[model samples]
Target: MDRVCDGIAVITEGKKGSWVCDGMTVRKVVINPVKAVDTTGAGDAYGSGFVAGLIKRPGDIDYALRLASINSASVVQQIGAKHGLILRALPQGKKWMHIKVEKY
Candidate 1:
């Protein structure tokens, strides 16, 4: 985890999830299901949100976690890694992308 502090590592746990730490402070932890889609590039989306939050408001751990969580959730709802995902900014764009989830 300390390696994450050096900006050299990011942890990804299959059953547990991913964790990023800075020196002694834990940056982010993301948990995903064991059975899911390909999950390719999912980490990119997560990292992007995390970095964006960090840049927008540095040291705001809670806000960064929330943003990363929302993005991660969105990524898992698709059939492929990057399908059925939408990114929009309010005011400029108020459109909606309806995604149906089937529960068994």
Candidate 2:
């Protein structure tokens, strides 16, 4: 939670983590977690791939979000984060891809 009193960027990450600075300019960098299995760097790879998608098609937040979600889902499906990873391109003729709906 943050409260903008005057002109400051007050960010609180957790109970013990907090920072206040000028809101005009700020750089946010997230640290990627290292995998113990060492199969591959799946999380970092997914983040980079998502960034590439955003760059290739700017202003498409929905598409970018989907790309990121799919990448993350694929990563967790295997024993190792990067093991058995598959990347599929969108079908040329289809405007939307068909996804199977599962009941939990």
Candidate 3:
């Protein structure tokens, strides 16, 4: 997959963890411990987390992956797909920490 794309992140479920490949670099994301209740919406959770991380952390694939991991973990610990969605702001020390989102 890395051969075709500039970077690729593979999300794993059920304690298997995740992996990321960005041409020259390959990294692993460890799963944080969380009780599982439902598997539905895990992908959406991961996508949202990844986008949030990209917007918040920019240029840091590792941070984005961790955010994705966190989002997915949170979702699976609840009953419904959107039940456990928790959006986190960028790190306090970040330069672009003033990102704001308005409903459209």
Return the top candidate by TM-score. 3
TM-scores for every candidate against the unseen true structure: 0.56, 0.41, 0.74
Mind giving the per-residue lDDT tens digits that candidate 1 earns over 1-104? 55325652446443355555545455445443434555665666667766676777797654554455445556666666676343543112311112111111
| Tens digits of lDDT, candidate 2, 40-83 | 45555456545655786885433443354344444544676665
For model 1, what is the alpha-carbon lDDT of residue 71?
59
Among all windows of 10 consecutive residues in model 2, the one with the lowest summed lDDT is 95-104
Q: What's the lDDT for candidate 2?
A: 0.42
Inter-residue clash pairs, candidate 2 = none
Q: Rate the local accuracy (lDDT) of all candidates.
A: 0.50, 0.42, 0.68
Error of 2 at 71 (Å): 0.5
Q: After superposition, how far is residue 60 of candidate 2 from its true place, in Å?
A: 1.0
Error of 1 at 89 (Å): 4.8
All candidates in order of TM-score, best leading: 3, 1, 2
- Give candidate 3 misplaced runs (Cα > 4 Å): 11-14, 88-104
Candidate 3 or 2, higher TM-score: 3
